[model samples]
Target: MTTPAQRQTALLVSVVGAVIVALDGTILLMAQPVMQRDLGASVAHIQWTSTGYLVAVAALLVIAGRLGDQYGHARLLFVGVLGFGAASAGIALAPSVGWVIVLRVVQGGFAAFLQPATLALLRLAYPADRLGKPIAIRTGAIAVAAGSGPLLGGVLVAHLGWRAVFWVNVPLAFVIAVLALTVRTPATQRGNSPRLNVTSAGLLAIALATLVHALADVPARGWTAAPTLLEFLAVIGVATMLTRHERRTTHPVVPPAVARSVPVTASMALLLVTTAGLFGALFRATFHLQDVLRLDPLDSGLRVLPLTVLMVLGSPAAVAAMRRYGARRTAIAGTVLVVVGIAGLSRLGPASTWMAMAAAFAAIGAGFATVMVTATGTVVGDAPPGYAGVVSGLKQTAMNIGPTFGIAVAAGATGTAASTMGSTLLILAALAALGLLPASRLPRRPARQEGEHDTTAALPAQAPTPQAAPARHTNS
Candidate 1:
């Protein structure tokens, strides 16, 4: 029952939210060197600015998604956008490195709320058959934000001052907030009214924090450090306890049955691998471009333009590919492209040409666009209606974790930055190759026909009852 104008506004809001999230990831890269010099920080301390953001985003995403479900998505979206903007402003005005880090954590927390709500809003706003176009548009926006952030950040940091990089979000957020007010809330209702499980949330946060600490310390202390080992063990133990507690709770954070589903598990795995490669490449590429290639921040950002452009260009084709070949084939094809792209990048040396790197980025960007679109569709399509928030949260979590793990591994690789990048790219390529294994197992067509009676009557009353037969393959 949504009006066309309403849908348009909703799409705009979601796109803006997504762009902000993407910018959050890449914008800081350009500002890092400047901030370090101004704040008189060590390399490790500067790196934590990005790490802290990732950790905060990862830890809070699920809880935020649930809050959107319990409260209202539109409301949460507004709050998140405003909070994010404020935090950005704080970062812009901060005098001390510690203040900047604290503000980044705030920005990440707000981002957590914004991201999942955007996805939930999209899922609610569009019908199933027509979802492709909007999702494609959303993917395109994310690519643009991510691809442009470095360049934009570089320019801002060099010419305007590093603070300008953050100030930019304030105006953008205002525009998005105004547009957001015009959108209609979806008709979906939460009947059970699940409350936030404080204990579970706390435990999960601690687990992630511990993991990040362990990862950060591993290189310096090695695996034998008593504290690192203890933190690792604590993370496992806390996570195990959280899982058990959630499973027994009447209203679990992530429902046990849904988490165990093949589609959900597979989709999460795809997200983890794809994001790890994409973010890892971004991190390393930025460093290599600036530190090794002697490129200015602006130049470094510009170097990644090919990747961004290709992602935008490749989105529609990816959607079409999904429709024609089914999710499995489309995903596998994308993964192959990612593998090729990473392998190509693995060939980079100290003397590699800019054109060579651009080509590598372009390949990776295309692959990333394809896989991201496909993986998102597959995960959301397979989720039960009531659990969309949780599914989206899980996707966000995987996305965050992927980058964190990738950076940890890549940073730890032996040799110079160029050599380490080569090795990391190869590892990423292997991960991309592994994606084919799961892609092969996805059902090639819809699991249900256009119209069929429900067979599983014992499912929860609130769950959407399936009323269709498995869609038959036309060829078969």
Candidate 2:
């Protein structure tokens, strides 16, 4: 059994790990232009740094999660945090842009290991019924990290230079490693030995990589472009192969049990569709604020501050609402708010006041936070402990793809920013409205029996802790 102290420590490590990763992602956006100039790299090369990281993380998440399930979440978290820090240090001291690209991808691989472990750690620490509050706190922490990223990046890049942005992660990683060591994760319950299907892993990786690449290419290369079409075809073909292969394999990448959970599947689908519409709307609004309203980047960021503020506030509130109302009602309410926010955004014109804009942004942020807390809690809470890592991996995968997919679709809408902005917002809002289908399918309340651990059907009731071994440290 996990003691309260250990649970608190787990929460701290989860928040810190999540913050650094989210911070790095957003802060890098600010430092990119500077890094390009400092490294004397072409625009495409600079863009690849971010793209490479995204692809690496997206492709390897499920595999990493499986490792966590097979080993221990705590063990995987330590290695992941340490490697992520080491990769950051390499990027900080890189002699060329090429090195930066390679290290970023390596860092992303570690990040994939880290992300799923965060949720899995929580799964081991907290019982299913008590998960919502912790998830709310985590959601709020992410909002804070994302909200502060640009400002923090601006400050770090302005004074310490672009390298300092990366250098900052080293200490944060160290702290997380220390905390990880202290937190005791419940031993994972597995049979004799779980065999990983290497061929299935490779196929899934290729399919996700191609899908992300195709979407990423959409802004620069139209849908009909040869490379884009070919990548999409590759994704379809590889996915087909993976499905057939998975059926025949005794040890599948995604277990059949996970695939059959209606609540879990619906939650993942809701997250993907909701984020696509929400983020797609945000992408278009960013351009409109700058191009049409002629607000400087700082001013535009300030106008959107309400969204961050509301998210931070709304997450905890969502937990209370969920307890009182239920996940389905809460999620549906949140979706309506998003639709209202989008409708409000569609009405904005050149003469719109900053308050009007901020109100709309706030609605979107608050609504999204509620959906996030509810959906994520549902996914993690409903998952069997044995499969926590992979379920978290699937959740993260949907999240990673959603924003990219949204931005690409938004970019594809025809006409100038001014002419197409309202129509695009409306289109996104309509798509978000469709999210109700999945939201309706969510559990009305916590589904697990009180005091019962959500364990897999085949897993043993009691797990044996592995023999104490020296912590394996990786050299940077």
Candidate 3:
């Protein structure tokens, strides 16, 4: 068993890993314009930097998760961190946009390995009863990283240059590596460890790539473009094949039995819908603030502060609510809050003030924090022992895909900023409403002892049974 000090050290390492993953997501967003100018990339090529990362992250998450289970999570995490740091360096020194995009994909693959293992490691490090506080702290770290990345990236890119944004990961990575080396955790090995389902992985990757391409293209090519149609078809076909393969395989990426569980399925579904809406809102709002509202990059990043603040404040409250009200109720409430928050955001117009924008973001941030914490708890809590890594990968897959779909749908819709916002929120509200049906199906608490005894006593009894005959004949 790990000592408390070791557990604490593990949590710190996990937190650092999470920060690095979150940082990568936003850092590139701010650096895109600079990279385009420096590398003479067309808009399409520059956009690939983000698109490739998302696709790779989504595709490899499950594989990485299983690798952690088969090998030691701590070992996999160390390797992932090292790989991610190296990829970041490559991105920093890339001679062309093409190489940068390639490295971003590699970085994302490493990120996939790191993310689920962090949570799995935490589960191992902490005891069940005491897990809430540490999970809350971890959630807070995620919120902080999410909120800070844009601003930090903006500063680095402005003064130091775009390459500096990637270079910043080096120090953080080194520190995290040192901390991770100190953590003590149990080793894991799968006897006759399953072979890599290379075919499934390839298919899924292709599907995600096509889907992202379709989404990205919607902004440039009208939705009716033939390429978009073909890409969509390709995604559907690949997904179907992948699903069939997983269902038939002895050692599937997502075991069919686990995926069919009510709690697991519900949690995954909730994550998918929530991610779609939240990421869509972020993408749209970012563009709206910068493009339509004409704010500078620094100001734009600062304007998003309210969401971060609310996320930080609300995460602990969410965990508390889960304990008191149960995961189902807490998740339902959170989804409602998200609906309200998105509605508030939909009200924004060209004339809206920064304060108004901030208020909307605050609602979204708090609402999402509630949903995220509860949903994660529900998923992890319901996962079977020895399968945490697989389930986590599934969850991450939903997370990655949802945002891509959301961005596609939102960007495809025709409207002014206000109208687009309204449409997107309406879609989010619909998805949130769908979450209520499943939320209602969570297992009910067992009856109290007195209630159970009283119920037993009320049952009708059969007639008294006669005693069995003795074996007296044999003695005679």
Q: lDDT value for candidate 3?
A: 0.72
Q: The CA-based lDDT of model 1 is what? A: 0.74
Please report the TM-score between candidate 3 and the true structure: 0.87
Best by TM-score: 2
**CA lDDT, candidate 3, residue 165:** 90
Ranked by lDDT, top first = 2, 1, 3
- Which segments of candidate 3 are over 4 A away from where they belong? 187-189, 192-196, 351-355, 415-420, 442-476
Which residue pairs in candidate 1 collide?
Answer: 449-469, 452-467
Clashing pairs in 2: none
lDDT for every model? 0.74, 0.83, 0.72
Q: In each prediction, how many residue pairs overlap at the backbone (N, C-alpha, C within less than 3 A)?
A: 2, 0, 0
Provide the lDDT at 212 for model 1: 68
Write the candidate numbers in order of decreasing TM-score: 2, 1, 3
- Model 1 TM-score, 2 decimals: 0.89
